[model samples]
Target: MATPDLRELYLSLVCLITLVLILVGGVQVVRHGLKLLLPDPPPPVFAPPPEPADSTAMLKPPRSYEQAWQQTERLRLQRQAIRGLLVNLVLLVLAGLIYRAHWRRLQIMRRT
Candidate 1:
């Protein structure tokens, strides 16, 4: 029975891991695209009642709901991008470790 080569095994492992990471990134991109294309329905708005004459009533500044929704969507996209970047970074680290192991094995084999 022929023994498997360590370098080839490690290289294949690295390639497989890289492929999986790419697929995951692609899926995330597609999901984000879909989210952009099909957004949730607008929130229901209720009219405010007449202000009471009581001097104790504190009035707060009015904020635009559309602006809030835009900010939220922006944050969501940013978070998704960051997540994708982190995943790619992890995959690169794993590949680097595997490559280092493969190089060490080659060095040892050469020394023999």
Candidate 2:
């Protein structure tokens, strides 16, 4: 019925948090791999561009908006890829930190 010591509680909490984070990171890596492997559903195509407000406007035909939209989509996809890579990189660092801590501890105990 005794309460757990603060240090033990904190350690357990940290271990639990690290385990959950590793699980989530692993899932995301798997999902990204699947996205690469499986063909994604086709992006819904947009309708043809509308005519400009000016009745006599014919010099440029006002297609700038649609072009901008296409550019935006490209940028968004690139951002997503970058974000995914960053998340994986962080996960790698955390995993290495956890492994190094355990390894050094083992080395110390062996010397003792």
Candidate 3:
């Protein structure tokens, strides 16, 4: 049996590394995508209402404040999910491309 050349070994190592990275990135993308698609509802706030102000200006209802909080929380979660998904997607694509390129190079080396 012939020993593998340095270039072949290097290409094989890179392909293996990229494959692992691709798998990890793909899993992360799926997880984030699911979170973005089906986010869990935020738990209800059971805290007491804010103290009444002496000002004549009308104060917002407690329920309205709770609703606003929920909305803000949801938006924040959505942004996080989107960011995670995008980051993972980029990782997956880059890893896949790298793996492909290296695998092709390795194959060509073997052929030659």
Candidate 4:
């Protein structure tokens, strides 16, 4: 049996670390994407009228349809950003794996 080379072991370890980071980052990106897609609780439709004695009190206006549409658009942008991030991460992970495979093949050829 051939003894393990320290350099080869170190390379393998580094590759494993990169793999874990890629997985973790992908998961976080997906989670954030889901959070963005989820709908927020609707605002209360009606509020109690202010007391007549409290002249300084102002009634809160209900959210308009335009305002709601804008909020939805913002959420859509957030989801799109998350999608881009995840896609980039997947590409990076694929590249890293290809590089590691090539490195391993070279190492094996050198040993023989």
Write the number of the candidate with greater TM-score, choosing between 2 and 4: 2
Q: Which stretches of candidate 3 lie over 4 Å from their true place?
A: 48-61
TM-score (all chains, Cα) for each model: 0.45, 0.51, 0.83, 0.50
Model 3: colliding residue pairs? none
Query: Mind giving the per-residue lDDT tens digits that candidate 2 earns over 1-112?
Result: 6565665465555656666777787778777665545534434445545577774455443567657766676666656755785787689669757755655554554455
Model 4 alpha-carbon miss at residue 1, Å: 3.2
The CA lDDT at 103 in model 3 is: 96
Regions of model 2 farther than 4 Å from truth: 1-3, 39-42, 48-79, 95-112
Error of 2 at 83 (Å): 3.2
User: Considering TM-score, where higher is better, how would the candidates rank from best to worst?
Assistant: 3, 2, 4, 1
Off by over 4 Å in 4: 36-59, 65-111
lDDT of 1 at 44: 46
Clashes of each: 0, 0, 0, 0
Model 4 whole-model lDDT (C-alpha atoms): 0.65
Error of 1 at 62 (Å): 11
RMSD of each: 7.0, 6.0, 3.9, 4.9
Q: In terms of lDDT, which candidate is strongest? A: 3
Better candidate number, 1 or 4, judged by lDDT: 4
Per residue, candidate 3 scores C-alpha lDDT tens digits across 1-112 of 8899899999999999998999899899999999998998977876645466763234444778889989999999999999999999999989999999999999999998
